[model samples]
Target: MSQPTSRPTTATRVYLARLKGTAVFDPLGDQVGRVHDVVVVMRLKGAPRAVGLVVEVTGKRRVFVPLTRVTSIDAGAVITTGRLNIRRFEQRPTETLVVGELLDRQVTFRDDSGTATVKDVAMEQQRNRDWHVTKLFVRRAARGGLMGRRGEGLVVDIEDVTGLAVNPAHQGATALLATLEDLKPADLADVLHDLPDTRRLEVAAGLPDDRLADVLEELGEDDRVSIVSGLDVERAADVLEAMEPDDAADLVSELPDAKAAELLERMEPEDAKDVRRLLAYEHLTAGGLMTTEPVILPPEATIATALAHARRQDVTPALAAMLFIVRPPLETPTGRLLGVIHLQRALREPPHELIGAILDKDVEHLLPDDDIGKVTRLLATYNLTALPVVDEDRRLLGAVSVDDVLDNLLPDDWRGADEEITDQAMTRTAHG
Candidate 1:
């Protein structure tokens, strides 16, 4: 959260807008996950009662943690018992995703003081140890305003707002998105998945190209397709261009042939060319799975140059794990493949040393037709995070990361590994 608040005092009223993305810690002072969103039970005549939290654990899997298990909610963290359910979270029929559903609601002050968009909702603990959304921080304008003015803002009891139940025909995402601006792409994708189509598209449109591309890669295929389809062709093309060549190709492959062709036509030629090349191969094969943008350096490059390339933020950790050594034309499908250099070896060598002198020439190559089984075996056997794929001429084409292999290998619902909760501490686990 905010660095342990510099001290540990419980908050009387917690604003969920601030709680999104906060750290969820076990009592032993170990972090287990993050607060993705608050789950609430919406009432007909009154405010929604806080049910629990949707905490995203490792592996991007989310589980429900009952508020009853929440020992404290301070400015910094939500401390809980170490015991937790390992099962996946499924929204109950009567539950509402407060962060998604309640925020940004266009509401009228009960006294008719004027309307405002809900910026954040505050929950207070009751005598019975229950929690309810008793207050709201709202703005007199849409976000600041439709014309971008610095609108009046205020915090008042929830009973003072009349439109809490109104589902506006159109809603602004700026405020809600701002609250979640720090979320990782995967976590953001989860939030988007739970939102209605219109809000999801609104939020998606607000994200920068690169950020949206990353989320697209993490979304379920159906959601990905739905979001992409909802966008006009040009926007879809831009998003695809921002993705890795292999990922872009996979997304395009999911579309109808004509639509895919149109998107490819609109993309920048160089990016389109790489994706088209990848599309030429069958799924699960080396060419299909490998990203065309792997680090490709010539033998003549210095160890220093290789290290510099590895340090670039654009290069993924898996891609940087191994450097593909080639003869000339460092781009994929370049000159004949020469050897490979492990990043560790590069670190040990003098910066001035030639990469060629220390290259691992014995490294095996994966052909375009090599299946995923072979890719997995090779990566696992050598303890390698990435492996090179090459053309028949032994020219470097691309490299496949272990993550890519896992994506193809896992079941469609792998993100939510749905095992029932086994922890005895969660015997009273909230509805899945």
Candidate 2:
């Protein structure tokens, strides 16, 4: 409730700070109400800032004070000289706007080509020690069909939106994107389906690829294809390259053949081949989730050498949790399938020991033709970071990382300015 020392830039600037219980006073110096909320009218270019103050005027009689006439503020109340009687102000809107009333409601705005919905607001504490709303988090619009039934979609950020208003009377209940903190992925997916296409895409582009992939997977094949189609090929390739090969393959395979080929053409050769191979199988099969980047190593390699190989590879740190040991000879080999070794355990052993000697001989793996459900269960049951998919002959084909599995399960809100979890970390100023 502390005020900033600087003069505010505009009327809307006054609404940037939270004002849940500020006092309201009239001309005779009599306190008329307690402010319960500050409604912000977000404006873009060429628009005026309008703010509505929700105030509790008397016992059970609530009024909205237009912020245009507010003159001053001190420790006790806000000074205003608006002409409306308390009852008349209350009757003007017919729709009550309170902080609590607006809590989970989806506020929409017109953007580049469609509408965006308020996903979250980004605020931070300044060096001078006042809090202010800096950005309005919006879910980018979704495309394809009405009621989330079909088509490709993409999510990205739409910057500098400045207006916020209530939906017209005929729009029914406002549907909002959930930021309730702990909602399950399933529930979050339902919320994603309710958002307009533009809002969904904006939110999607902001999140990390892993989380976005999880949400897309949860949306089912058609929705996933639609969402990916909205992204440029480069963006799509970046996402595909980041995802586990199998999952990436599954998404691309679901796209129209032309689009899928175009996306593949944009990816790195090794990645393109892996995805193309995965596309040859039914989506529900294990091949759909198999990656081609298993941690292959030679039988002659010592623990020291294997460790060095993992560091040199582009595989994520998570994938290094378990390192795959293959024959030393790349073309043809004569060693048995040495058990997989936990990268941590391998690191602790004496440097001179060959990797095969330290491996846990009992290896559990799946054939490429196996069901995806089996692969998921193995990942969950053993709490693995990367699972190796093999051929019927026990030769390694590729690997699936835990991150890939998650992408298949959530609505991609990839981190955006609005989804920013970290506000500036503020330290209290010492008294001078």
Highest lDDT model number? 1
Candidate 2 CA-lDDT value? 0.55
For candidate 1, lDDT tens digit of each residue in 201-224?
A: 887875645568889999988888
**Collision pairs in model 1:** none
Give candidate 2 regions above 4 Å deviation: 1-194, 205-223, 300-320, 328-337, 351-353, 372-387, 400-432
lDDT of 2 by residue, 145-242 (tens): 57443222222222444234444342222122214113444555556666787766655554334345556655666556767888767667756765
Location of the lowest summed lDDT over 10 successive residues in candidate 2? 423-432
For model 1 the local lDDT of residue 368 reads: 91
Number of the top TM-score candidate: 1
Error of 2 at 98 (Å): 44
